[model samples]
Target chain A: MARLTLDALRTILVACAGEDDGVDLSGDILDTTFEDLGYDSLALMESAARIEREFGIALDDDDVNEALTPRLLLDLVNGSEVRAA
Target chain B: MSTQSSTAAGASGRRVVVTGLGVTAPGGIGTEHYWKALLTGENGISELSRFDASRYPSRLAGQIDDFEASDHLPGRLLPQTDVSTRYALVAADWALADAGVGPDAGFEDYDLGVVTSTAQGGFDFTHREFHKLWSQGPEYVSVYESFAWFYAVNTGQISIRNTMRGPSAALVGEQAGGLDAIGHACRTVRRGTRLVLTGGVDSALDPWGYASQLAGGLVSTVADPERAYLPFDAEASGHVPGEGGAVLIVEDADSARERGVERIYGEIAGYAATFDPAPGSGRPPALGRAAELALAQAGLTPADVSVVFADGAGAPDLDRAEAEAIGRLFGPHGVPVTAPKALTGRLCAGGGPTDLVAALLALRDQVIPATGRTARVPDAYRLDLVTGQPREAALSTALVLARGRHGFNSAIVLTTHRP
Candidate 1:
């Protein structure tokens, strides 16, 4: 399976929770914390549920919470996919 | 309860008045538009468009067609709230703005509160979550469902948005609960709260909600919008369920005057609620008692009330009971009675507050909007039903009545503010 990319994650974030005005998601944002990127815990939880359903991956609540940045979340999701395979 | 104790508790001599109104009804979105629609007798009931209701027994509804939530609410709130909450938040925004309570208005957070009513919670949000539970397992459900499906979510969200940390509650007595919530808010204001955002807004038109409404056996199954849901007409069958309602900024008269509030809609003179005796017990229904108690609390008589906003249940037995109550209280065809909800079907928890708004508007304009599309009132009912056109009258006081499904009756008396 292909790794989860920042672009795919951005799409999921926008779909699960709406983007804040003036917050550019297309920039170099992988390392930016979700709080700085204007996404809250509820938004992240919604994104995680959507990702789990779409990518056939299981994500623990702790892992989702600990993945503060898009890079960390993508790594956690891809790691879960590899382990499931 | 003794009359003295009840009077002391219910009417503390502290005046509470409605300063601003925000409405999102079937025919219109704002108070002005809704009032215009009501005066012109526009029918908002139509074929249900929220979903395909072809399979349901009742296929028509009073649905708000052009409400785009994204235009009124912020982006982040779009995911966490349901349509009903969206309506309420927007209405609260309009009401607060109308009341001149901007961020710079300098009201203490604890001085403002919110009280609302809802018969069903966010049924659409719950239905979506339940579908995911049945299809993809419970893990797929969104976390937002925790608060979004609650009946009190409207009050919670409004309180958080506006930082109204004072006394807050959510009532649920079906249609009558709307009036009960405002009645409680009146008590809150009398108890020293400066202002309370009180009213009701409801939307349960989803397939699951529709099924439950139909199960009640009171919805009009008529297909045509013109002929369906005729309240008080001789051929009245049943009411069409509707979405949306109204919210008002109820404030202490002294506080409003101190704040330099320019317009006071009317005073919340009196309010009362009663439960009917058990069906077939041979005791009379208690709707008239509720009205009498409200008037007595206001220190007024039945003859002083200029207009009566009837419940207009649309079903034969319920309409007959309401008509007989009105006839007995005000004498046969003695007082002008109207049901502007004939335009927007029964709104459950939303109906009573919306009717209250209509009554206040009538008091403001000094004219009674006609009962929409109900012309052939039975002679036996003996209701001086206002029809055909808005009637010109010297309106001073209005009584709004509402009844929930299982005999919950409530009445509110509004008198023009004196001094």
Candidate 2:
């Protein structure tokens, strides 16, 4: 498995939230919560599902709920990859 | 000249008037757009593109195009509801705003109510959820699925969102549900509630919804848009299924007057409902009985109704049964008949309320809009069906009719608000 770059992680987060180029999915907003980013629980659930499918990793329901910020979700993905390797 | 009791609430037998109307239909999104397109006799039927209908028996429907919920509703509502519910929310907003009430308005003090009817609620959403359950897993299903597709979701959601703590209810009478909702609201006001938000919203345009409707065998399979849904014509094949609805604010006449409501659309003069004979019962339908009973309730006779909005089911026997009923009541060409559903298709639960809006508009404008695509009334019927173009008349009272698939028949009478 390759390393998860910040840019790649940001792109994945953008696609997971079903957002287009209108949203600035960059490191500057990594600390922002999904709710602040205009993404509701349903949107975040869908984003988590897409992330799990793409990363070949299993995500816990509680983990998804606790990962309120984009950076937290990225950390979960990177941790899952490290464990897998 | 009347023995009806008049209370402080102005219960002249508890008179109820339609104070405001909101519509989202196939041709347009608002009431003005609906009435304009209706009067112009524009065709709203087209190929069903909401889902893959290539293999379905019925390929055509009155699908609403370019309906952006975000454009019509608030941001918070975007993720909470299905297309049908969103349509209902937008329509409710229009109705409340039209009635000079809102979420923060002083209407909260009054006994306000809501009754939204639907035969098929959250069908598209349910279909999507079922697909998720089948293809993915139960865990993938939306949490909103539990209430989204429930028949009462509209009533519940509308009541909660608007903070209407009065007697809220959901009517589940199939196509007659819309009229029955208003009928029930009228009765409720007569019993005591001051204001009622009532109407219907339905969308069955998805694969699962369309498949279920197709199994019912009443929808037109005709590929031609122009010849698909001819309600009263000899060439009438079958009805087209459409998605949309109308919401109306029905307030006690006295309350509206006290609130200084300037323009009351019309009074819900009378309403009656009856059942049709079973499919193989070998008996004529009782549509005329419902009409007569409704008219009698309004303290009116057959001669009083200025125009008739026929149920216009579009199936041969159904159309003939309705025509026979009109002939029996109106004495052969005595009343002008029109079925504007030819333009918007049969909206099931949504049709009755939509027709109510049309009837009120007809009363206001004194013009009966033509039935689209039905060039000729069948020769066997001695009814004066409006077609080709709209007809100008001294329209003061209108009769709107609706019939559900399984024996439900409803009639509602609306009279212009005479101050």
Q: What is the TM-score of chain A alone in each candidate?
A: 0.92, 0.71
The CA lDDT at B48 in model 2 is 89
Worst 10 residues of 2 chain B by lDDT: B1-10
Q: Which ten residues in a row have the lowest lDDT in candidate 1 chain B?
A: B1-10
DockQ, structure candidate 1: 0.66
TM-score for the first chain in candidate 1 comes to 0.92
Best by DockQ: 1
- Tell me each candidate's TM-score: 0.94, 0.85
On a 0 to 100 scale, what is the lDDT of residue B17 in model 1?
A: 93
Task: Give the Å error, residue B162, model 1.
Answer: 2.0
Enumerate the chain B TM-scores of all models.
0.97, 0.96
Clashes in model 1: which pairs? Answer: none
* lDDT tens per residue, model 2, B247-315: 999998988898788889999888989987887989878778888878877777778889999999888
